[model samples]
Target chain A: MNANDPILETLNLVKEFKGFVAVNGVSLKLKRGSIHALIGPNGAGKTTVFNLLTKFLAPSSGMIFFNGVDITGERPAQTARRGIVRSFQISAVFPHMSVLENVRVALQRRLGNSYRFWQPENSLLQLNEHAMALLADVGLETFADTLTVELPYGRKRALELATTLATEPELMLLDEPTQGMGHEDVHRVTEMIRKAAVNRTILMVEHNMSVVSSIADTITVMQRGSVIAEGSYAEVSANPQVIEAYMGTTDTALQGAH
Target chain B: MRLTTYVYIALAALAVLAPLIGLYPVFVMKLLCFAIFACAFNLLLGYTGLLSFGHAAYFGAAAYTTGYLVKTLHWTPEVAILGGMALAAFSGLIVGAMAIRRQGIYFAMITLALAQMLYFVCLQLKLTGGEDGLQGVPRGNLFGMLSLSNDTTMYYFVLALFVTVFLLIRRIVHSPFGQILKAIRENEPRAVSLGYDVERYKLLAFVLSTTLAGLAGSLKTLVFGFATLSDVHWSMSGEVILMTLLGGVGTFFGPVLGAGIVVALQDNLADKVGSWVSVIIGAIFVVCVMAFRRGLVGEAQAFFGRKKKTA
Candidate 1:
């Protein structure tokens, strides 16, 4: 219950899929109210760490602690209920629902009325103003009534963020929040993430270095299922081992392309 | 108000006026019963995107129960129907718990297999009357007062039940709970991450669908004066799916339209074409799948939806 205790901590987490190790003995910590980034090259198992932390995948060995509670054996929904909500690498929205309704579904979960099937939906009209406010926060208020599937890819990502924000997570885990975005959307989302990071802890798996350097309070660099470096952006960027891992992967990828 | 709302009001008016217009009361009652059955089936297949190939279990089980109660116990019609519905809901809960552990085609196959088991149990049970089935089921008085012996009285009763169940389904589809079910259908992982107990929601939806299907079966037994092997057969489950798909799987009135067409087709062709009815129905299903794909109501909605956008 100490104020300065790490909001989330992992102790020697290991995940193996058959003969292959996806996350090997990875221990990490995030201080309260800080934005932490997990970055690595292709096949570096960055996504595996996020999955293990969110309990989407169980660890072969080790434990995860969130707010001084052990949650390694918890299910995905249980972890989310404990305030560790996540967004998918692929844009995940209720495609047929309107953008406003998408956020309202999340809000309805918070209100604990999702099981009230017998009641008229108009009784939920009171939630409209709050749902619209969340949409407005993500700049989706203009397209509030648009079906989520019809939205442009960038806007769908924004709507996804809006829905995730509706849950009011204590530790938000965003997997590739700005993946496949153009330059303009990348900047917009980075700023949005920075704004959202205030007064909450964030642990994100991002490939864009600019987004990582701009918003991340601490960076954990992984290579081949283990942490290679951990520090501030400047310190991690300058680390020889980190640079070598990136350069080595780029050369290997270029050679494979030939 | 939406155009669909106006259409629903007009349809309800026609239903009320049908018996007065010299239409066959018994035939219309049969159509109404099947329409309710199709709507209940659509709730799972169309809206929730769970294709249950075993809905006949609930529908037939309820029919048998209602038939037994009315014939043997001399229970009132209303009490018998409620009893059947409750039994169906309980059965739905047990079956749903096991079936929902799998997804996609596996789920469909499991439901089909379970329903086949139920069919065998019905065939062996003395209460179900085996092959000859439960016959001469009395359509008792409404609340032990008004006589349901008159065809017109029975037609109106069936119409009332149909409208009530239809409105209940409409209310549920637009409710907050329905929104969560749709979310789960669209992306289960995302719904799970949103802290919704997805399996529980799915189970509740299954129970709701089966209970309504049971209501329809009970009404059908009262209308036809029998609960036969045809009611519980796997082909009945397939017929409900056909109704939903042919009418438009996800559209509100699609199943009703599908059921009307199917029932009317069967009634007209059964005497004239002998066993060719199955062949003709199969042909129509193939054409619908290939050309329309969205079923009758769905295609009509899209057609008018485009017209509105252009206008």
Candidate 2:
């Protein structure tokens, strides 16, 4: 894709905590409606990158452009309002709330009606309908009445995705959506992301190489807080630098594929 | 558990039959006062996980305001109570803004120190009667008609205020803002990353808790027809903490039960044990911390939770 096709762009992104750079001089572009995968060894600063893009952390020096708008140093809510949303690597859920209530809260936040005090919106016909549709979309309708804490881990992840999707983001930044999942769950979430990608652009950090190899339209490899390689999965897999940095030195770059 | 409906029903029953409960109407008024105090504390500690130890500052400030207005200024009872609420809210807003900058243990200490400072200020202030505490506050008519000179009417009026405040708390807790508070408590970093202004939420919850604490303090002054140094003391702060802890921090009715039990215990024991009353309350606090962890309603919920799993 051409550079102009970028939906999200970060220029010279830098994040430092107590003089130790977590993310340093990182620049990347995410194309519209494409799955861009960020992969790195532990502490390659993938999560930091997500935090910076989501404005959870202010960059030390950088500019973030989403849909050609400068969003650097904006609050996370403002970023989210401008159609950017994120799901955490750890499960970020309201365990005390029912699944439906959790989705309804997100929907309520999206609708700007969460501050309404008088009536119970949980039972409202339109809100419940929209929430039920979201639950069904994420295949969580069966577990709708259950407390999110009671759901199996895989289902909690699904609920997280459903909740994030309810925010109506144009770009969804998912961090390790398949981590700690069984084989079946890994496949389920992989498929779910693929389905979700039809409407929203996805920028994900993936540790599972096979999952990334399958779903990633483009791959960006980072080490020591900087991008070391960027290309299509096939092209990047062929690059020997990626092999040495990620999988140790090998004569054939694609040797790990088998 | 759909428990809110049952709680409402029980509150209605209590409201109707409070006079027949055989507790002195004054003692009942005291119970209602502390119940409201506990509810306010719960808004922060229970919902926001922001424990505040200086709540007595707001509570005591309102008490002092009510006392001074009624006794020296001769303000009507309603006017005095409103003034107390307004002043308490202002106190909460200012203290909450500063205290919210710190989290966990530090927040508690900041509030404690602020309340202690207020207590000392109240101690020497002449309008507060310099430790004599604005004595002999007249119980004027409620709305300039039915005399609050009657104890039963005064008891009912306090009870009515308690119920209104409790229901308002319930409304706030179930509202969207309340849900956000729970979200913040459960995972603040996540709430912020999801676009919430978390500091603002904490500040607001703190302010609300302070205002309600003040409301309880003001009402207490009216029932007793005076405010004393007791209202502003560090011991009063400790007492309110004990009530919240014993009542169940987050559960709706736990504070009320906890308040009634603690107040009755203090009342009954005061004549026999005298100054040893603080020791006994402290002992209950230690025991609750060590054994109960969840207090009365919390333990009940846990027990029922296990049964639900079995069933």
Candidate 3:
């Protein structure tokens, strides 16, 4: 792949659920090593785009290229193995497993030892130190032995990030990483994401504007399943079309709150 | 040594001494066989979270296969059992492949439907002897050496196989592959994103459970000297589920304990209560579900676990 070529590119992606069009002919690109944010009001198809890119949902008519290779028909696990790992909008940690085990499982997948049923789990003990290191990276080292479900909400998100990072992904797709968090948690997680994006590509869907503005290198604003504005945070925040979309949604949300 | 290890040793010692203590060898052997069957079923339901309502298909299918081979072909008991196990594994592959396409209740229904179909097929087949089943199947010589016709010799053989299977399952449940199976059970989409092929893992687990259930059925045929329609019936499937649920869904020794209780209940109650045995079992099931939802061993563990925490 050429240096100037984007790491991920989508061409006229379309997704229709029976009569309703969830995502309509949206094209986008993510440059290498950049923290790109996908922001939109509710029903703007931001999540649909994320799902389409991760191969969790097939596009009705579109092409997705990762490293300039068409990956439209690949399965979710296939795309994951190709280094496109995603975190769910909900906290996706395995509740029954210990925090340490959650990360080691992902590391075990990376080592291709998932099919080794004959070997005892003690054989994977050597992975513990590395799993702990990743936990430390996400500030979850202290909770390594705790059951993941027992963790506080913010810590669970950190554990999810640690597990996702354990895959050593080339493209990390985080969906609403800071959703449903207090002010302290949002700030901590934003710092965690910034640290994690140092040498990798991150495409995140975040509703928290302060978090997005502080870390997002490029922001793409979406409205009605199409890209309404694309630029730096300041440029997109200043665009009239983006402003109108946000104002309309905010007004409707305020009315609904009544 | 761990407490469980000590418990296992004591249990083995008791099993070895049971015949000398006037305990009926054949009854004990029957209990061992059912315990193995229940353990195999638990491996899928408890650990993997795939409730297959069709386990009787593998168990009864293997019994028929082993009975036919030993009775008609005069094969050694070992060879017949292996043949039965292989056949069961193959059928498990086919059933598992189709059933895993759906999940939860749908998966259970599909398995139940497939097993019912197999039951009907067995009813019409010439080799299976239809409703009467393959009768008077010889126990035959073990490996063409030791005679398994003797009840005590057969008891030892059954006990040995049961212990081996139990240990093997324990090893599997602690293996890395088992860990992944647990992860898939806990969360499927997360497992997929972690790059583990969840379907393949589930299929392999299903096959393993089926092969072991076959092992149990083959031993039952050898011990009882018969294979019958009762073994393949849907009720047999339901019985195993009751045993697993009562013993503990995921605990290691729960199925064995559950099987023992169930077998003993049926054996003792069949003579005294006649048809009332089903009523008593239904009552116990209701009581168990209401008072001990985590199951016998599971509740015990929780009780002791809380004590330890407090201490």
User: Per-residue alpha-carbon lDDT of model 1 for B68-150, expressed as tens digits?
Assistant: 99999999999999999999999999999999868999999999999999999989988899999999998999999999999
Ranked by TM-score from best down, the candidates are: 3, 1, 2
Per-residue lDDT for B114 in model 2? 91
Label model 3 with its docking quality class: medium
lDDT of candidate 2 over B216-301, digit per residue (tens): 99988988888888888887887877888898989888888889889999899999999898788888889999999999888988
* DockQ (model 1, Cα): 0.78
Docking class of 1: medium
In candidate 2 the C-alpha lDDT for residue B180 amounts to: 79
lDDT of 1 by residue, A118-142 (tens): 8888877888999999988889899
As for DockQ, the candidate ahead, 1 or 2, is 1
Superposed model 2: Cα runs more than 4 Å off: A1-5, A117-125, A252-258, B1-15, B20-22, B308-311
lDDT, candidate 3, A67-143, per-residue tens: 99899999888999998999999999899999999999999975667777778889889899999999998888898
Choose the strongest candidate by DockQ.
1
lDDT per residue, candidate 3, B1-311, as tens digits? 26667888899899999898989998899899999999999999999999999999999999999999999999999999999999999999999999986889999999999999999999999999998999999999998999998888888889899999998898888888998998998899999998887899999999999999999999899988899998899999999999998999899889999899989999999999898988888888899999999889889888888978899
Q: For model 2, what is the error of residue A14's alpha carbon versus the real structure, in angstroms, after optimal superposition?
A: 1.5
lDDT of 1 at A144: 90
Could you give me the TM-score of model 1 versus the true structure? 0.96
Question: Residue A245 deviation, candidate 3, in Å?
Answer: 0.9
